[model samples]
Target: MGTLRDLQFALQLKIEELRQRDTLIDELELELDTKDELIRRLQEELDRYRTTVSLPGPSVVSAAASAQIEDKQRAARQTVISEPFIPDAATLAMGSHKSCDKNQKSSRLIKAAFLKNDLLNLNEEEVRAIAACMYHTTINQGCFVLQEGSIGDRAYVLEEGRLDVTKDGQKMRSVEPGDMFGELALLYDCTQTYSVSAQTDSKLWVIDRKSYQTVLMQCGLSHQAHSVELLRGLSFLQSMPEDVIMKLSDHMKECNYTDGSYIIRQGDTGDTFYIISKGQVTVTEKKPGREESIVLSELCERQWFGEKALWGDDIRTVNVIAVGEVTCLIIDRETFKDIIDGLVSDSCEEVQKSNASKIKPDEDPFLVSSTLSDFQIIDTLEVGEFGHIDLVQLKSNIKHIFAMRVLAKKLILHNSQREHIRREGRILMEAYSPFIVRLYKVFWDVEHLYFLTEACLGGDLSDLLKDKGNLDEYCTRFYTACVVEALAFLHCRGVVYRDVKPENVILDEHGYAKLIGSRCMKKVEVGKRTWTFCGTVGYMAPEIILNKGHSISADLWSLGVFVFELLSGGLPFDDCDQMKIPTTTIHGIDRIEFPEIISKDACALIHTLCRSNPLERLGSSRNGAKDIQKHEWFEGFNWDRLCNKTIPPPVIPKVQYPLESSACALYGEGSVKQCMNWDDF
Candidate 1:
């Protein structure tokens, strides 16, 4: 009876333990199900992210669609919370620039500052538009406008009251009305080097970097469209390409004159052509002997004056006087020189050069005419996006070192660079300057195109910069002079060297700099525009990135960037995120601190060259490159030596190196053959 009772009790205990074990297993499975559901949701998100950010656009997006996209972008930006900047309603205000209640006086003050401001070389219209985007605000006397050593995102303009700039406990300068501060940080997104404190209760106007850029981009688009139509209606400019007209409009400065002001003096040198946009002007011409001028015509809205200037008259035949608070749009003569004449004849048959177009290739002793049998390929020097540069030498003489740029026909066709390839050949044939590399002969095989040219033994400026970091002012000036000369040669021929960067400029044994990488170059006829977006990413000019018509001034912009990099050992618009480079470049260089090594003169030249308005750049004057050559920075620079190749180069490079094997052809000159045909040889 005792054994039966104990077994029954033990069996009941075992049943209860089994039931508890089943309940625990069910709970564990439920937890795992929840985790798996979460994982599935996350996987969907990962799939969404796999789509590329750069979506292809088959057609231009409508303005309404652009607005919607902008709204979404703004919403996305708001999710990224920075510091607590809600000091006032205006300080951290979020919305479109148009939403802000702009202070006219404050905007006028900002515009005035921008006009004289070297960093922001924007024109009158652009300045006015950008200034209106600044929000009006006020701060207490004790508050700091900007804290030292912090990352600054907004620039401020004091409308009223006093402020002081201090660095490391030392007061530097007293801020005045209409003065823009903290712009360096805002433009370049750099750290503030000093602190700004309000000495008295201050009324201020401020614009964050984001808001300023948004407004700027919108303003540019609006202004460009408006200007294009305005230009098209003008009789003298009606035939120009729409894109060219848009570019011309960007360069056009808006000028306001009181009633009865002299817009142009009869005898004064006429470099600028003007189109009256808002009011009437009286045209007067002074005859050779007459002291008083005779009225030629009464010009009103849409009427233009000084049309002859662009076509190379170099003089204003008549005087223009403003009537009733007139506003006029003006373009300088040299800004678009002789556009119609760009396609003039003088192809390969026209150049042997030294004396130019008349000299035959067979007669010129320096010219090399040869067949395939005369040369042998030595080794490959460089492989590029479109081609590879090979070191080749003359067989019989064995000393002529040449860089044979071999391009695969298939690659060129694949990249759709056929026109570019042909244009390069034409340019190389026509171009004859000491700074430009000599193109000896062109060859073609079954699958490749070959350009036999001068060998630059010293490597490119990129390599030089690596070996010698941050070149000094003197060295920079000399190196840049070479590039300037090359630009002058190309620009004079109506070609724009779109890619002007350190990597594209190579040095020879004598340290003479010559432009290479002609892949990004094209002839943008005078007063014409090309919208092909080509060139180095970080070195592209604002107009080029905008896809607005660009010309020689584009090269000048890159030259400024080149100067900045040479002096600072980095680009002024460099960003960690590659996507932001174009955005930063479009914003201009108003905010970055120039390296301590750069001088005021160098800064001035850079500002002049890198102006947002390309037509207003330093070399866009009637004197062309001479204006840059005459800059204070190049005060004593001998341009003659640069052009004549008589200047002493800053660095000499070693030309000799061991070949891949045991033998290599060196260098020789003065060789010619009767046959120019490759097939016959």
Candidate 2:
């Protein structure tokens, strides 16, 4: 019975233990369920935040905007924190350009440190403006305080520095505190002669000359000696209107002189007169002084030199070699006279009138340094032949108009037509006929030779034809007469002008014609004749195509074609296909046609000029001018007036051309011919 009872107790205990284990497992499951629910709620919150905060795709937010948003988020987060701190206005006052009012000691000290005793008189605004003008500059030891030979723009007052002054490499003196220097270049009418060097690391108050002058004027300090010095430096004395020198005369101390120094150098003339200012100075003899040595003389402070030079005599009479170092108040001539007359001189002292057009200087530093080293470039103007030509203005406004056959530099060295073009220019100059184009001068510059002459100014006949389309009877007669005169002169001179075309004929301002380029200067072999046909394609005669040498008469035939082009607006016989084909090249001079509208007399003149045989061509005689004079078409015209008349220029070039941009492209005589034709042989 005892054993059974023990077993029942054990079973009861085991069952109770199993019930406790089931309870623990139920608690564990409940905790796990609670943790899963919390995690899901947090994930939902995060997803909602991401929808508002995160950017879509690769879209970027700017840093500034992002910072602002982040600040807003931080503010929101701080509000949730429930504690915030705000600073008072007093905190903002601690950082700024303003000083504290309560700190009167510090404020007063700062004000006093900046404003000297003299500045105490100025109001706050005036003080600030004046202070703005004053700049503090630091200089290293041994560095230049002010350099000699440099334009003086600024003057300095030393605050904490020592400086040494040297004149022309000689030591003058050293200065301590409150010493001022370098008012000379600014206050005197002279180039700088002294250099100031810093003896120690220094601080200085610098003011520009203009500001300094303003300060002096405001102070009413004309009675001071520096006023005279200031007046001497100014260029436009007549503009001054007030004579400050008389008030400052007593302060103008005289300077002394010694040997071996110049009192006044010969040929170094200026307007300023000097009191002998003590000591002896030697006057230089003419011959030796000009080439070598100087002479001497003795004078006093009341005595003066170079007074005559100031009164219109520009040449210095003597070279005064000082027996010693010279010192003088040395007022400028205008300033002295203005002070004496109690009036300001109205004369500009700095710049002198330059003689650029009339003459070139023997030693022109500007030209030596300038890039235009070749043919002297003068100006471009509307001229004959080319429509626009360059006029090379020589010494004394003597002008030359040139038709540069070539402008490109490369062709000058390698092109074959250089000799012919040069010869043509020379021949034209030699002819000196009023009808022919004249050459004035020739020179090589920038790798190209320039042929300068008077510009025709009325533009070329080609331009006229292009502009007018067709010529009137009066225009036709006028142009024809001028050309015939030119051709007659060329023929008499034994010159054959081959390139006769509208472009080769230019009109003067009065509508008279002038012949331009010539192709008759080609080198002819002895008895072998140069038959390389050259002329305007439409204007060439039939004989030019037969490999026959052209004579001066060929030009007359060409002139007839030119007149035809002028009157009819187009070539009489223009078959482009025929002109291009070698077999069909024009070989008949008589093929030229006349318009139905042409007058009989004009037609007769054209026939004579355009004859198929060179012998029959007008102006073909040995006395071609006489023949042209006898033409019936020129009956009423005054031959003398027509030949000798000077037409007023069309346009006077009035421009101060900028140097670099004005240089024309130098296409030499050779380069120009490269584009022209000389293919027929």
Per-candidate local distance difference test: 0.70, 0.50
Worst 10 residues of 2 by lDDT: 77-86
Top-lDDT candidate index: 1
227-299 per-residue lDDT for model 1 (tens digits): 6667888776666655456556666777889999999887677778887878898988889898888988899
Question: What root-mean-square deviation over C-alphas does model 2 reach?
Answer: 40.6
lDDT for each residue of candidate 2 in 1-681, tens digit (9 for 90 to 100):
235644554465356446646745764564555455345434544554555666545435576687698665333212010011111234222221222232344333333433442212233433333344555556667767665654455556676769888978898898665555553322222234578888986766665544433332232222233445444454543354332433223224455566576667667757766654345556665674366664455564444566675456766777776766665655555544534443222122112112212232243333233221234434444222212345433222223223332232333223234545555765654656566666544444444444545456666776677667878766776776777777765554446677776766776545567887563443332111233345544566655543233456667877777777777777664654322321222434345456776677767767787776665677654335566667786677666666766532232223233233233333233422111121210
Model 2 vs. true fold: TM: 0.38
Query: What are the models' TM-scores?
Result: 0.53, 0.38
C-alpha lDDT (0 to 100) for residue 223 of candidate 1: 54
Give the runs in model 2 whose Cα sits over 4 Å from its true position: 1-406, 412-415, 519-530, 578-593, 646-681
